[model samples]
Target: MAATRQALDWPYPPFEIPAELYAAWDARAHGAAAEAAWQRRFDAYAAAHPALAAAFERRMRGELQPALAAQLPALLDAAAARTDAVATRKASQLALDALAPLVPELFGGSADLTGSNLTNFKGCVIAGRDRWGNHLSYGVREFGMAAIMNGIALHGGYIPYGGTFLTFSDYSRNAIRMAALMKQRVIHVFTHDSIGLGEDGPTHQSVEHVPSLRLIPHLDVWRPADALETLVAWAAALQRRDGPSALCLSRQNLPVVTQRAHADGAARGGYVLRDMAGARAVILATGSEVSIALQAQALLADAGVPTRVVSMPSTTVFDRQDAAYQDAVLPPDMPAVAVEAAHPDFWRKYVGRRGRVVGIDRFGESAPAPALYAHFGLTAAHVADAVRAVLGTGAECAA
Candidate 1:
């Protein structure tokens, strides 16, 4: 091979040369020259792009920033003022609309589901064949989009993100795993998170995706409840530098059940959203089901069964919290019940032996979201009933 390479002039490494000579040549000449040239180019680029250079510097310094985090309260306040329910995906878009302009290092795109994913916002420019742009138009290719975002994150100088339906995350599974394994800061926007994405049927429903993604070590899976939680999820994804984040958003509109005061606790991954005197049980929920849990809380109150509601958006993050905080939020002695529009098995660990999970363990049908929720027993009354069952009280207990 060496002789053939020499003859063909393929520029193979010079094994015939003395080891000392090659080492000395590269250390004093080739390597030094390359380092100097690269340094000069880097300095030029930094001078040309001050904002981007600063963003990279902040990232390298591990500055989990609060400046951007401080702005979240105002956004939450704005969301609370709105009377209508908002889809978490659309809420995420509103968040991006406010924060994207401030983050020059943020580069995002959608896998040909731009309208549905709401990843692209106003003032966004698509990367063309010739010149570079902030966003990509990854057409109908979930795996390709995820892999390319991984490549971009590996290359540095930009925070890469991509969007697709929650069910389609299966296609990007390997790439998403690689991101978690490498501890890369890549964000995945997975909308249509549950049977709430009605009419799409079982093929498009994401019954197991959120829990499956949570099983990935080092990856943060956030199923935010409302606009405020959605913004917090986005901010958390941006601040995290050691691992990837998956934002499992909702298709159906979620009532603004959260308040501005919950912002700090929300960032903790889980917090008690509603506390009641003489509470006999705790109801844990995420995403669209959070509102349902709140409604269940009301029903339980009316039924003379006091219960507290805990909005647990990110179980991975919650698990990382201090034992004191975890215990404070979820006491071991308390009977707990979890409600979500996904697989039931994932909640079993949290709910304990005495508790139960109100979730869909079967395939969804094509129908309106409300009808699906009703058929699947994902309603507030069902959750209230679950709490009653866990507490050993039946319908007769409701006054």
Candidate 2:
């Protein structure tokens, strides 16, 4: 519907602005520049889409609700505990079970890893054959999965989703970019999101994928911290009507954070958890890294260094908050550390140049995920040490 609303929809002028001339050309774009001229037409094109206008009509009358309006976050924490047991497999079955009635437009599939991706929707009135059921079984074709999802979204009757290993998103990168360019409402569920993929090796572990996905303009990126966080991420994807979103989750069973998930905590991106009475450093993390940061917070407290752990599930949502909100949550002044299994780029903007980040700038290894994590210094102790370095508190955080 928003095929014309995104920046990628801008028409290419007859005279191309060479990519190499970005610096000089950007400087030249004052007011009457070609880019500005192009924007007017793009804006006009956005207004021209008939279905888009209809969607806006709902929003104007308050018919639309924020995607993260309720319970999914808590669902994630609950799921985290279940993942290590037989429950991970069953919860997805339960997801299909719950959606059997209400989410007629809902669709999903696996990238040849049905047993692992855990996204299978059974019982459909329309598809007739269980073979072509509402949910598509995309086999190992990541590109086909994304492109097909784009088509499903463009058709206006469905919210298509698919799953694959986190590292494999690269195979579908072009299709995903097109979805962002088209502003399609598709979801990509990536499992085994880290070195925790274990013996699968560097090619399988998703080290640089987080920032790579974040770099896309219209995509919302999520790395859920627990089972409940996973639910929030899923609900957020369903609620976000304008564009695409991805949920990155662990292959290993990470300990659940709270007794249960809190929906509000999952949607707003970064939320403070386990704060010290007086915090000297703020440790921010997403996905499994949040668990590490939480442990680091406790260890730092025991050593007399007060630290606050921040769980950041979605960067795009957090960026939506006002400056005051961002300041309140991130507080540029606090000594900070950003931790994740992925590359460091995504955290820099949040933590600031002076703040430290415990992340991988390199590829993962073929060894067991736990061994690789310790080998690369990605532990609670490592995150705490980063905080200690920032605080200059003289307390050793290393094990």
Candidate 3:
């Protein structure tokens, strides 16, 4: 080939370079010049349209919409006052319905699970070609929906979120990682967060999704216990401009356990829900498990164990709190038992060496929610046993 090229005098002093090749070589410069020219035009337009330009700039900075900010306090108050039992997902729907109208930049939809995810709100027009809309129908594309949310966030002027089953977070894991790496404020609504999703089988249940999502740096994972906590989580996710957030919601109804006075404490990620006088041990739990922990506290109190229940909705946020707050919530001197219907490994850090964890390290089985709880030993009885074990009052339970 070399001899043939020499014979043809290819690209040497005897041959000229192709015009197309030269044009191709110059394309980068041309593109740069074009971009500079477009920027200059944009600058001139911005100068002429100062107010619009300022709004655009502010949106890119991820500033909360002024109107939305004004309405947040009252909306949160209303959400906190809700005393009826409701699933966290439904509570999220109510929150979105109330806030979406005020925050025009809040745009989101589910991955073809709108009915189950409860992500769509009233007045959210479907996005279509040649017309802008607030909500997008992501259509059963979990990974695609997450990637697209990242794009929307990176493009600016909108906060984007998407929903899917917590078990399917595996399919969107890489995209979630990218969102975290980019520090985009993309919200992921993961419903049916645990085996409590019931009768869906182990295939549909999320045994480790909560801890898995929590492992990702810069990604805030929240498993709210009740309607008020869910509202606070949603608010925190929207207000978080520097990172992504995962809201782990339950399918079963959760009663409003945290009183209105302490409801806002959800923003702190972990807070004392029920404190008992002369408490020697603390029960830490999240999501549906928080209610179980509360029940366990009552059981322990009846047994003269004197236990406290700490609702830890978001470990990521709690870790960011001051040492004093952390110590106050999970005291060093007091024994603690962490409870969740997922992996136990992550809880070992909060619960000291002597402390026990009430969780299912193995896959779940097909059964009713109550049966699953009994089989998996996730009931208040089990949590109370674990608390007693941690306090050296009883033998260690088989959790």
lDDT of 3: 0.88
Candidate 2 per-residue lDDT, tens place, 216-240, comes to 9989988877655666666677777
lDDT of 3 by residue, 1-399 (tens): 789887986755446767786787877888999999998987998999988888777888879778777877787788878889999999889888887877668888888898998888988888878888888888878999999999999999999988999999999999999999999999999998888889999999898888889999999999998888888898899999899999999998988888776665779999999998999999999999988898888887777778888999999999999999999888999899999999999998999788999999999888899899999999888988888776677653333
Q: Which ten contiguous residues of candidate 2 have the minimum total lDDT?
A: 83-92
Best by lDDT: 1
lDDT of 1 at 135: 90
Model 2 compared with the native: what TM-score?
Answer: 0.77
Q: Where does candidate 3 clash, by residue pair?
A: none
Model 3: residue 32 alpha-carbon error in angstroms? 7.3
- Candidate 2 ranges with C-alpha deviation above 4 Å: 1-100, 121-132, 259-261
Position 228, candidate 3: lDDT: 82
Better of 1 and 2 by TM-score: 1
Candidate 1 local Cα displacement, residue 381, angstroms: 1.4
Instruction: Residues 121-187, candidate 1: write the lDDT tens digits.
Output: 7788899899889899899999999999999888877889999999999999999999999999999
